[model samples]
Target: MNLKGIHHVSAITANAQKNYDFYTSVMGMRLVKKTVNQDSPSMYHLFYADAQGSPGTDFTFFEIPGAGHTYPGNQSISTTSLRVKDDAALHFWKDRFTEHHVDHDPIVELIGKATLSFRDPEGQRLMLISDEYNQGVEPGIPWSQRTIPAEFGIIGLGPVFLTVADITSTKKVLTEILSFKEISEVDHFKLFETGKGGSGAQVALIEDSEAKRERPGRGSVHHVAFRVADETELEFWKNRIEDSGMPNSGIVDRYYFKSLYFREPNHILFELATDGPGFTADEEFDELGKNLALPPFLEKDRTHIEAQLKPLQSSKE
Candidate 1:
């Protein structure tokens, strides 16, 4: 069984309201889900993605009130990349960021792709990578209703960056257990890709042995998930990961898709997720994320869940 590409990247946020504002109003991504974190029903878990909330486009967050600041270091999912249409789109974002006062750097070339690095208000590290010449995994369609033009809109997630203390052990887990192939390495970073290699199916690794381990808080990535075709394949991965002696969360019914989570050698969380029965499973195509949604298991506690969350939208926009 081959892992397709990045499924989603979940992160942390201290304030859900501000997170919603920045992503929807600034980043131009659609809020596809405004539900509570299933594992911890008291706080909100938001999902931002393309028009359909496609598998490869999902960027989610779990709100933790008064979450502390993140101390960036090794053994962390250092940076998350968002894919744009081309190099021109990369510059358009630079100009847009200036208008909105978003913290970002000038465009620079990385492994032949134009890249722009930026940070959110909470100090979340992010990059916008051009997919102009991408020939591997396809990107998702950005939300058409967004203020940003479709041509320059973010299409999907790109290579996830990992900073680890032990490059040898992390490389073994990736190349051997996860089946990633090294495509290139430059300076201090090494690029690995799985399945059909390209910007969409890649992970960039940076070994920083001198840095201390990351103190995760608001703005830190929670985990990165890779795509599996379906539950059958996910089951196969469960056994394979188990055989490799890496402890994993066995098959979990996430309602939208099946999932099993595990951490690689560097203590970075990784999840294997299916691609079917996605965001539209419970909500209508046009009505997604308008109201709070709960899974079948959490339906019984709807009243309590609603009471805990501050209303994401004052009224339907």
Candidate 2:
């Protein structure tokens, strides 16, 4: 049961319309799904991904109005990184950000790859890394109406950075349980790789004992999901996690994929999700993200859910 890489990274946003605009128009990703959060039906849960809404390409957000700002500290996902074609793609994004008046940092070299760091409208940290090494790994499906061309468009997710208060226990869960191999270390940052060790396969842990713990709110990563091939693989992880004394949300049918959520030693939320039964399950391939989608369980309350959600404008509009 080998975990592939990231399935998706979910965050929180205070303003649904602003979040929709930045991810769809500015970032050039397709609004793969428009739905409401299962637990909190009044809040919108938006999914943005590649044209096909591939597993590793999803970056989601939950609308949580009036949520507090994220506290900068250890024990949280500090940044979510996306993979771009190469250095040229990074330059293209740089110019795009400048033209749109989006504040971003200059491209810098990290882990021997060109990286461009930036923030969303809500100040959630994001980065783009050159993926020349993993060009053909899984070049994501390009949205037809994308502002950026397919060649220089963003690929799947790249390495995600987690700030941990202590590396000892966290390292144990990552290596022994999750099957991550420690590839390298730079100063206090340790790099771990799963599967093929490029693009979405990497995760970086920054040891920062002196830093404070994080508070969940808008602009904070809610959870980071990792990919499992299918239900069999997901079950393997569920058992492994439970047997190892880790508490998990056992076997949840999330419509698009089955998932099991567990918190690591540092309290960072992690999810093991299946790869299939993708976004196309509830909607047609060409009509995805065109209307409100609800799981069968939530279908009965569709009218109420739609009434609670704010009307969002898509880039296609």
The digit string of per-residue lDDT tens for model 2 on 148-201 reads 888777678888899999888889998999998998887457888887667787
Model 1 lDDT per residue over 1-317, tens place: 57998999999999998889888888888889888888999999899998888988999999999999999999999999999999999888999899889999989988668899999999999999999888899888988744689998879999999999999888998888888898889756898999887888899998989999999999999999999999989988898899999999999888988899999989999999999889888999888888999999999999988888888753222
Candidate 2 stretches with Cα past 4 Å from truth are 135-137
Worst 10 residues of 1 by lDDT: 308-317
Q: What global local distance difference test value does model 2 have?
A: 0.87
Q: How well does model 1 score by local distance difference test?
A: 0.90
TM-score against native, each model:
0.97, 0.96
Alpha carbon deviation, residue 235, candidate 2 (Å): 0.9
- Listed per candidate, the RMSD to the true structure in angstroms reads 1.4, 1.4
lDDT of each: 0.90, 0.87
